[model samples]
Target: MKALILAGGKGTRLWPLSRELMPKQFVRFIDGESLFQKTVKRALLFSRPEELFVVTNRDYRFRVLDDLRELDVEVPTGNVLLEPVGRNTLPAIFWGMKTIQEMFGDSVVAVLPSDHLIDANEDYLTAFKRAERLAKNYLVAFGIKPTRPHTGYGYIKPGEAIEGGYRVEEFREKPDIETAKRYVEANYLWNSGMFALDTELFIDEVKRHAPEVYAAFENASTVGEAYVEVPDVSIDYGLMEKTEEAAVVPLNVYWNDLGSFDAIYDALEKDGNGNAIKVRGKNAYHLGIRSRDNLIMTERLTATVGVEDLIIIDTGDALLIARRGEGQRVREVYRQLKERNDERVLVHRTAYRPWGSYTVLEENDRYKIKRLTVLPGKKLSLQMHYHRSEHWVVVRGTARVAVGDREILLRPGESTFIPAGVRHRLENPGRIVLEVIETQIGEYLGEDDIVRFEDDFGREGDG
Candidate 1:
């Protein structure tokens, strides 16, 4: 069976850490491995790398490529489908299914999210076997056995047994605590955001139910064109709730969406005081006196006194302090910042580009300083800025710098300048990372206002 992974969500609930350029899937939170990597590793357990497809937005294309490359599990870059805009799950899944039909005709496909944690390795295999048997006549969805009265997830009620799975009786949204307890008492399973279906069968149902979406994809010549016209909706609202061929297979798996800080805290190993403390180095000390059930992640020594049920995340440029359960409401903070045109809401202190990454070390009204790291064998786009003039000093490795019309190779402690409106590009020809200190002197030194003459990553006028 082919595997389809959805990796395009903004993950606004996980703010301060998850930014526009880098979402939660790519960030390493629970363990050293990212959620996307974990999901890919899980996907590989059943399907080969060749049989996997990642559906994400154009903005996340490079991050996806970089993450997959780091894993050393190379798949065809073309298999990573780039959506022009996010139209939610319906279009994304439909596009993947259509592509699967073209590549491997009428095959069974499993749809999974890239940011969820599930360890049903054995149970998952069993569920897949059941799903394959049932997918001939039903669109099978995996349901998790609820451990508590969780109001964050939807509920799936299973009817009498039908071959390998049960007929789906009804689907319910997140209910009140009493209602959730009632659901648990009645043996309703938590709706796991996973589905296994026959590609041809799913397409047929979409054609019958979500014909507008079907028409959009069917008429377009390329994935980009299809994405431009596809209406933004979800599968549950468009097809699953309307179709008659729905079935649920009870999957006894350890699953958590990790949608909040509390969920993340629960997933991590806690200390003696029921706190999750992540220290930078062994020499650093975190003295938490009278603190309980808190999460403290920092790059330096962080001490918490008389604090409980809080989330303290320090990313150098931004520090977030919020009540434990209120982490999901961090979207409101993002919205407020966005309304005020704050860059902190969109980009992080350390912004990643295709060539490398840059961190805003310091900034002010007249000048701004940045620490730029260019990966070996990669070059920044040959571009020019209209408002800012830059001075670059090589700190670690050698840099091949192009300033205006003059080309020069600079070693450690070497410096160069590019006047405003002059074409320039930075390249690294060595085997190590090229670290440089860039100081900018300009009136308005925003990230925009750049004219690219050439680019290697095909990123221009897109962001």
Candidate 2:
């Protein structure tokens, strides 16, 4: 069996903590390992590293590489597929399945989302094996019995039991609270968004059900060409609901999509007072004073006063305070921010690049200051700013600097100046991390004001 992991979720509801560039899958919420890492580990249980494949956004190339390095496992280089743009689950799944078939003809593949949290104990393993067995004749969707009226997830009505699972009767969208309650009362299962299927058979079913989607990719040689014609539809709408082969396996294990703050709270270990707190470091803490059943995830010492069933998430730059039941509405905050062209919607105060990362120390109308960290042997683009002049002060290790025609090396406490429109590059030639403080003075300072003469990451246009 092979593994096809979809890792292209934007994680809008998990905002402030999960930004556009740094989504939930790459984040280390519980242990030091991320959800993506956990998913990879889970896949390793049933498939070899060479048989595991990943589908994620093209911009997340470095992030995927970074996490793979963190896992300390050497997988095949050709297995990670990067989608230029996300067209929802159907396209990602289709492309992944197609790639898998090309690599290993006629296969039983388990489709898993990289962002979900699942306890892969005995129950999970049993259900997974059953799903795999059923996949020879069915496009198996692993379903969790609804613990409550969860409006965040779609409800799947299970029909008669087959060999090891049930045929799917109906697929329901996220409903109102009353509707969700009714479905839960009727023993409806929450759609787990995980599946197992035979690659060729699944494609045949997809072609039979969603011809436009099939038309989009069935003839294309590359995913890049295929995605251009792909419709923006989810797997439920494009294939699952339409396919007669759709089946469900009851998975009685701990599972959560972590789609909302309330889900995060539920996934967390609660204290004696029913409060769930996630602190970034020792200096930051949840000092609860008569606060019960509150979920606090912050980077500072946060104290609640007489609050109950509240969700407070502070990420230094933004704070979200909502009722535990109202976590689904948090996506509205992200939508509003995006509509208003707020930078917070796109990035945090610190931004990560392919080479390393940089944190905005201070910014205003006239100038902006940033602390840039360049990884060992990594270099920034040989580029120049159109509207800004830069001053770089090396603070750690050694920096190989290139300003205009001159190539110079700088040590700690050393500095260099580059006037506007002068080609400059920063590289770390040492074995340690090189830290530098960069101050930019300009009439207009924007991240897009770069003209790259050379780049190592094959990047162009705005960063």
Candidate 3:
């Protein structure tokens, strides 16, 4: 058996904390371990490191690698499939299944989404084992028995009883509150988006039900080529709902997709006043005098006087305040910001890179300041800014600086200058992490001002 983890969702509903660059899966919301890491651990319970696979976009490549590194789990780098562009779940899963077929030949593959919160208890293992047993002939989906009337998740109605599972009667869309209540009353399961797929069975189903997607990958030489021709469709619409071989396995385990702030509120521990508070960074605290049944997440001192059933998220850069039931509308704010090309929709104060990370201290029309941290033995791409001249001051450790034709080493309190159009690179030569305060001044200080001549992490064309 093999495992394929999907980690490419944007998580727009969790904005102000989750961004286009750092989605919720990579965010360390529990015990300093990302949801992606937790999902990897769950996959390891059934499959070995070499048999595990991950399908994600190029934007999350380093993040996935860094998370796996921190977990001390060694998954073969080749098993990490990087999609050139996202084409929804169907294409992603098909790509993984095709690869599995080519490598292992008709294996049972567990498909798990990386951002979900699921309890890996005895029930979870048993449910997946049952799904695998049915996967030889059925494209099996693990359906969570509805705990309540949830309007957020799609519902699956089971038909005839089968061994360890049931044949699917219908796949219903997300419903209104009244419809959701009916679904719960009828014993419908919440679509968990987890699956046990036999590569051969899944491939045959794709060919039978979704010939367009099947043909797209059939002729394409590379994943990127296939993505260009593939339509954006989910597995539910493209294959599962249309296939006769669909089956649903009841997974009676604790499962939460954490799709919205309301879900987050439900998952968190509440105080006596029924307020859930999560404070990040140093000296951050929340004081709620008369607040009850509220979720407050902050990075600084916050005081709420008389709020109830509210969601307050403060991330130093942007803050979101909303009613508890209105969590799904947060995606509207993300969509609006995206329409305006707002940077806040894409990144926070700090941004991560393969080499290390950089935090924006301040920025204006003609200048910007950033604190850059480079990991030991890592170097920035050999690049030049056409419009911006940069001044770097070593704040900690040692910096190996290359300017135009000269290379020099700078220690703490030392500084260097690189004029516009002058190619330069920063590196950490010592064992300690290097920290530098960089100031850029020019007519245009956008990130796209870069022109890379060489790169270490295959990011030569990127700005």
Instruction: Return the TM-score for each candidate structure.
Output: 0.96, 0.96, 0.98
- Across 385-416, the per-residue lDDT of candidate 2 in tens digits comes to 98999999999999999999999999999999
Worst 10 residues of 3 by lDDT: 26-35
- What local distance difference test score does each model get? 0.88, 0.90, 0.94
Predicted candidate 3 versus true structure: per-residue lDDT over 315-347, tens digit per residue: 888999999999999999999999999989988
How many Å off is the CA of 295 in candidate 3?
1.4
- lDDT assessment of candidate 2: 0.90
Which pairs clash (backbone N, Cα, C closer than 3 Å) in model 1?
none
Order candidates by TM-score, high to low: 3, 1, 2
| Candidate 2 to native Cα RMSD, angstroms | 1.7
Ten contiguous residues minimizing lDDT sum, candidate 1: 277-286
Please tell me which predicted candidate would have the highest TM-score against the true structure: 3
**What's the residue-level lDDT of 442 in candidate 2?**
97
User: Judged by lDDT relative to the true structure, which candidate is superior, 2 or 3?
Assistant: 3
> Model 2: residues >4 Å from true position, as ranges?
177-182, 460-463
